[model samples]
Target: MTAPLLVTGAAGFIGMHVCEQLLNRGLQVIGIDNLNDYYDVSLKEARLARLKKHKGFRFFLIDISDRDAVANLFKTEKPSRVIHLAAQAGVRYSLEHPHAYADSNLTGFVNILEGCRAVDAEHLVFASSSSVYGSNKKLPYSESDPVDHPISLYAATKKANELMAHSYAHLYGFPCTGLRFFTVYGPWGRPDMAYFGFTRAILAGETIKIFNHGDMQRDFTYIDDIVDGVLKVFDNPPEADEAGPAYRIYNIGNDHPERLGYFVETLENVLGVEAIKEMYPMQPGDVQSTHADLTKIRRDFGFSPTTSIEEGLKKFADWYRGYYKC
Candidate 1:
């Protein structure tokens, strides 16, 4: 038997799925999430319900922002590896609730770092986001690309996390791998996401807003692919590299940037309902496009996303219809 792994944000969309996979692999996992009502607590509860069924999965309802709580968890669990995914999400919401970002992404992350430092974990894998690229004109955002400018506070925190992890890895001898996840979507997804929201709006015949007049692009990755890449990276930690930083950062994306118009059309085809798109100019803290250059992850973890948007959206739509009884 191996040491139990500690996964923060275990009840989240990505977190729950990661925990499920780890548990299925016969690994002991202690999952933690504060269960904040960012969107709908019931949805989180539903995700947790599925995880609770696993014998190897243990859960703790605690917020990572609480330094004392996190330190105690680490001291008690003594997990050899840690996966930190808890953070205040959403770009537009970050503008309204900037402190939420600071509390969860900044202060909360400090607590997580302290926990890992205290325990002397073998490795720490955390979630970053494509938003860290900000408004870069680069076609495919690569790990080697500069991330000095972050348009949204949410993106800023993710960028800060990569820096924070690197500094911690440098000061201490622990290995850290940070993953910049692209637009992840699938069953049990976050309601605030465009794909999820589009599904709901299209079902309810509500008008869906199309930013930048449907001219945006995103490398929409599926949840399973994200989980697969994460686990592969977790099993391997960053070591001495020539060009990369003291810590490693990789992009886990579909490597296929889909146009917003096409993505919506795919959704419409999947749900069998045309969307009422309200075209508008770009909103603040929003980017025109996001394309992930997956060379690093591919070479490192053999990460290849197989789910096409059509197939993935069909699964999401079917799940949504059944879950909502629509």
Candidate 2:
């Protein structure tokens, strides 16, 4: 029997997709998630149900924050590679629940590092976010850009994760790769994301709040594109050199950015319902725009996001109507 690859947050939108792809490739997979009610528990369960259909996949209800449980799982499973994606995600929610960020993003990440060390994992591929580019006025965020100033607790935690991962890779002599994902959206996406809420509100004939008064931009990369890039990165680990440890960071995002109003209009068109828009002031801990420089990812892995906003939203809308029976 072959050892399984471990994936944290296996019930999550991105995690579920990654797990499914791995399973389809005939790889043994061990998935773990706490099933927290960060959003609707049913949705997570729905995702888990889909993965359960694959015989190559196994699951455990474990929280990454629990040090002992994580250590024990590592000792038992001894997975050669780990894809860590579980974390307390949300910018606005982080303001109200600051402790959640510290507990999950900070302490939980350390536990993951320890587990990797215990198993001598070949590579650790983890999720970072475009939020870490906070306060940077630069148009396109690059891997070499300075991310010292993060406006939200969520972004701060993500930045900290990168630093933490680098330190662990340096000390433990294990390769680590961090992917900084931009505004990702598609079918089975996070409900907290603006696009998801916008779809729901549009279909229900409710008012959709446009933050920053509809004056913002986002490089909304689709889910399939993200999964494609992730698998490519997972297969290739960085080589160690005299200058630093075997660690690398790349931005996985669509190179093109769309305006906020244009995005809403596109969504409205896709859902066949015009939303009642209400412009709102700039919210705290929110940036005006996010654009990713994908040169490194493209150069290294030949990654290119092919999904357009219109096409992606249409797929999401079709899934939404069918899933909700609306």
Candidate 3:
């Protein structure tokens, strides 16, 4: 029998989709999440409920930062592979609560590594973010680019996680892959994200804040594309490159950079309601633009994001209206 897969943050937006995809492929999945109120707790529960119906899925509510609980789960499950995705997300929120990032991103990730080391998990894949590219004027950020500077505490912790994972891969010869995702959006996305928030505000007849005077651009990747890229990486474990390590980092992005104004237009078109615009300077932790250099990921895993902004946003808006009864 094939060994079961362990997925941390299985209740989260991307995590839920990943778990569903794994189950559809006939893989046994073990999931863990703390079910924190960072967003709506009911939404998390709803995601979990879907997984609970599947006979192949087993879920435990545990925070990865708790070393003992996480270690116990690893020992008990003996999963063949681990996908670590739980973390304190949001850049502006990180400014107000820096310690959350430390506890979850740093401490939590450490416990995951220890668990993997103890159980000898065959492969470990974790989520990273484009925020780590931070303030780089470089148009398309690549894995090979230097990411020493981070604008927010959230970005810093993610970058640190990648470095820590690389160390483990080097020392233990464990296969580890880190995916640096661009702006991911679709159904079931975090409400704290700009796209989600903007939709809410615009619907409520409130002015949506357009930072950088609406000059920003982003590689808005669809959630399905992100999930497909992640699953592809999970299916194919990294081999030690001539660089002398089995660790790999890939930028999972749409490759199409669209302006903030264009994004808003797309959203407005989908909702069939014009947004009240409130232009503002870029926030302190905000970057002007983000573009992904996906050459390596494409070469490695045939990673191609096929969703266009118009189609993806339309689907998200349709789901949003139905879900919220708007």
Clashes of each: 0, 0, 0
Clashes of 3: 0
- Per-model TM-score, in order, reads 0.98, 0.99, 0.98
Task: Name the best candidate (by TM-score).
Answer: 2
Q: Residues 189-277, candidate 1: write the lDDT tens digits.
A: 99999899888999999999998999899999889999999999999988856754448899999999999999999999989999888
**Clashing residue pairs in candidate 3 (N, C-alpha, C atoms within 3 angstroms):** none
Task: Please report how far candidate 3 places residue 170 from its true position, in Å.
Answer: 1.1
Between candidates 1 and 2, the lDDT winner: 2
State residue 115's C-alpha deviation in candidate 3, in Å: 0.7
Note the residue pairs that clash in candidate 1: none
Could you give candidate 3's per-residue lDDT for residues 169-288 as a string of tens digits?
A: 998888999999899999988888999999998899999999989999999999999999999999898889788788999999999999999999999999999999999998989999
Of models 1 and 2, which has the larger TM-score?
2
Off by over 4 Å in 3: none
Q: Give the Å shift of residue 150 in candidate 2.
A: 0.5
Alpha-carbon shift of residue 319 in model 3 (angstroms) = 0.7
Worst 10 residues of 3 by lDDT: 237-246
List residue ranges in candidate 1 displaced over 4 A: 241-246
